[model samples]
Target: MAYLIGILITIIILLLGYIGVIEMQIRSMSEQLERRLKAHTRQNISVQLVSKNLNQLVICINKCLKAEENLRLKSMQEEKQFKEMIANISHDLRTPLTAIQGYQQLLEKGELSEEQRKRLAVARKHSEELKGLIDHFFEYAYLLNTQPEIKLKRINLTGLVTDCLIASITSFEEANKPLEFEETAPVYVEADEEMVTRIVQNLIRNSVEHSEGTIKVEVLSNKEGILRFINPVREPEKIDIQRLFERFYSGDEARSRMGGLGLSIVKLLAEQMKGNVTAEIKGDLLEIKVTLPLAQ
Candidate 1:
């Protein structure tokens, strides 16, 4: 009876020791998982214990890690390829576009009949539109490929927007659309000057192209400087407010040609300067708003 009792005691001690080992192994695995997640490392989980269940768990975890790494690498490769493709296409189109513009300028300088002159003017207009489209494409591709170096400074938002609107007066006249801008007090913001100018220009151009009636501009201030553009759209139902800022997104086929890249560029530039843009439809009107941080 004494020998049997001794054997039982020994067996209990061995079982306790095995359980302790397993607990330690589990703790080590947990720590390893945490470190791997924080560091984004490619290391696989490993177990020191010689238990079949623990080994199987480790195997499953390692497989999952390997799969995740593969997916990440694949996504990176695809993105690189897409950027390269855009860059190449933009570069290729630029040469021919430049040549076309040069020829158009030469034709303008030559003497011709009134009918010929009118036809040349039409051709010139179309060519200019094409050039603008190509320029937007190139700019969009460049923005995607490189991180922009933003020069942020305290700028008068009211003055800047006013200048942009004045410059766009000719465009509005050409489009046979009226523009209304109510002057407000000087609103100051901390933003990149060039980017802000681009944003305003793009917004104005979008309105000129899409607005059915008078285009309205307003500047307001709360905690941030807000620039608002309100325009009556022809078919409000066609415009998807949610996808307005998406690259190459357009509400209709006609808009698809002229509206490509403009809003997307505005969105990207605004985000780079720590600003935001939003669009909504109210009745027959489409209102777009841009908000920037106020200068201290």
Candidate 2:
């Protein structure tokens, strides 16, 4: 009986050692799988193990990893196809749109009766609006499908916002919207100059289009680059600030047909630069803040 007990103890010890080895292998495989996934590799994941249960667990994990890899490949293919389609459509439309605008200009230059001139001006106006919508569509498609390499440099946020506001003064006057910009100390950030310009232009344009009162842009130089745009909402209660950054999201159903890519693009660009953007509606005041890492 003593000999039988000794044999059982030995078997138990061997089993525990086997399990410990299996556990260590599993941990190492898990780490390797994570590294491969992070590097976006196509290597098959498999780990040898002694215990039956552990072998089964590795099998399940490998199946999941394979499925994930397949899905990733499929998504990448679809994205490439979609980007190509957008480029082709944009080029096809731009060629004819440019021709139409050119002819419209020539027509405006030619002699015409007062009624004829008014009709031509109306036609030109609609054409210009169509052009703007197409441009937005192109931009949205590009921003949504692909991540472009941005040239990051130390840029002055205050001066950039000021420049955008100054350039938009004429439009503000035309829209009868009072524009105010409070200049603070120069807030510099490491960001793509062109992206910063686009973000500012889009935010200001969004505010100008939606605001009921004055549009105010301010720069706050803090640990993070804080560029704020303040505007009074026409119906603060109805606006969903959370949905403002969603692609093709509009405040109202009436404006749904209007291309709503401006703020969405801003959010994407901000995130690509490792920055953040948010909107808050307090009573009637709408504040949109864009924060980026401040350059030392």
lDDT of each: 0.90, 0.84
| Candidate 1 weakest ten by summed lDDT | 252-261
lDDT of 2 by residue, 176-244 (tens): 899887788789999999999999988877887777888888899778999999988877788788788
lDDT of 1 by residue, 213-294 (tens): 9999999999999999999998899888999899888886656887468889889998889999999999999999999999
Give the clashing residue pairs of candidate 1, or none.
none
- Candidate 2 Cα errors over 4 Å, as ranges: 51-53, 106-121, 140-151, 234-243, 253-258, 271-274
lDDT score of residue 138 within candidate 2: 84
Runs in model 1 deviating more than 4 A are 1-39, 45-58
